[model samples]
Target: MKQAATASLLAFTAGFVDTAGFIALFGLFTAHVTGNFVLIGASLADFHPGILGKLLALPVFILAVAFARIYVLGREKRGHDGAGGLLVAELVFLSAFLAAGVAAAPFTDADAPLTILTGQLAVVAMAVQNAASRTVFAKLSPTTVMTGNVTQIVIDAVDLLGGASAGAEIKARLKKMAPPVVTFALGAMAGALGYVALGFWCIAAPITSVVLIFFLRRGAASA
Candidate 1:
């Protein structure tokens, strides 16, 4: 139950940050690599001035994942939970992202170094989350992206409605998958609305959630 709650909160954070990045950074998707690829192609064809930042995001994301994997492996070697360490790293990166965005307010210059730097920080934080979800929280449903989750939800719904013999199992699957999807949508909505109202300060929502997750894990470990 605790794991599920934590995963849901992480999903919410991903959605929140991704949406905020999209709006604040001019269509950049920190959490969605596939979308970034499409945007890159479009930018290349249209000669978009921000193409450099978009092009850089993919490699930065990959490097972040590599760093996270090494960090997690080292922690496991020393007999500790790597997930907590990864979460802390993510929080730090996100804080840096928010700080950079604030310092670079009115992102009118797409080619500005600060604009690219802030975008890179957001992508790096989300890449750590992607790696952590796959390694540290492998047992939990993915919290960064929604494509697979939605597919599973549809399949499970069909099986349940089709009167599968494993009704309880299907129900359990639904319970595990539904909350994150719903919360992610809600988070995206909140992210958009919050950005309109609070600008970069909107990040406080996800930052608060990550802090809660860290403390919750600590409490669980202590207990």
Candidate 2:
């Protein structure tokens, strides 16, 4: 139960940050970094100005994931839980993202130095989250991206509808995948609305959500 809840929160954070950053930074995808490739192509074709930030996102994301893996491996080697530390690192980067975004709000140029800095902070934070999902939280459904989760959920649903023999497994997969998808959609909507209503200050909600997840994971670990 706790794992599910934590995963949901993490999904929400990713959705919220990605959407908010996209809107604020001219379509920069902090969580779904690959999406930036498409945006970069579009920029090149259209001669847009935000290409630099989009160009930098991929390498920054790769480096962040590498840092996360090293941190997790070091912790595990010393007999410490890596997830908690990764969560803390994510929170710190997220807080920095929020601070940078708030300070650099009302952005007029996506390729501006401060704008790129803010976007990279968010990318790093989400990269840590992606690494955590693939590492210490491998048992949990992916929280950053929803394409696979939605695909699995649909497959399971179709099987259940067709009266497949693996009903139990289908149902289990649905239960595991549904919450993150739903929460991610909700977070995306909320993020769009929040950014429109409050600008970058709206990021505080996701920051708070991460704090809750940190405690939730700690409590679950002790339990």
Candidate 3:
């Protein structure tokens, strides 16, 4: 349950699954809002989905937060994953959802109900991961987000050179941050490989995600 290993598992899994969501589910990026915006905008301009699709996805970001709070409450109620457990369960749900999506895909084509259902499912997962990462890493700092992580790494590097007391904190932060960066990169690489080798066999996303979560939950238990 080293921080490094936990990050390695979560980041790689996030990237791999998020990339799969993007590839298989038409352009939804499960983790990052930057990519989400690009996809949503394009879909709006082109597809102009009925309120149902947007309605389905509209509250996902909010729902992610709600899910995080639910985890928070779960800990408060039973004191399980503590605050960190919230993040762990978030990843756990994503893994479970991906499995559901893999099984549910055929029934859902490019149509509204199917897309809406799938979008809602993924959105809920992203919402959980997003809020959990934001809170869990507030102290140690979380790197599950590549866009923010890269930006902060630059900022931290600058702060490290400032000869301030906070430099120690910055260095500490970067140490925790490193694993996610590396793991996410590996996921991106693996995603490309899987897409090439498997083609429509995108079932790799959910299956590998389940494996990652299984290991992650094991790590969390021992943590």
Instruction: Return the top candidate by lDDT.
Output: 2
Error of 1 at 69 (Å): 0.4
Tens digit of per-residue lDDT, candidate 2, span 92-152 = 9989988888887889987789999999999999999999999999999999999999999
What candidate 3 gets wrong by more than 4 Å, as runs, is 43-55, 82-109, 136-140, 159-167, 199-223
lDDT of 1 by residue, 46-94 (tens): 8666677888988999999999999989989999879988899999999
Over 1-223, each residue of candidate 3 has an lDDT whose tens digit, in order, gives: 4546656665775677667666666665666645655556676678733334444454666766876777676776775655456545555666555566655654345455656566566666666656656655444335346877778888888777877678778887788777688888887677667755664355346446536655765777787
Query: Candidate 2: misplaced stretches above 4 Å?
Result: none
Task: Sort all candidates by TM-score, best to worst.
Answer: 2, 1, 3
lDDT for residue 116 in candidate 1, whole number 0-100: 89
TM-score per prediction, in order, is 0.96, 0.97, 0.71
Give the 10-residue window scoring lowest on summed lDDT in candidate 2: 40-49
Q: What TM value does model 1 have?
A: 0.96
Put the candidates in lDDT order, highest first.
2, 1, 3
Q: List the residue pairs that clash in candidate 2.
A: none
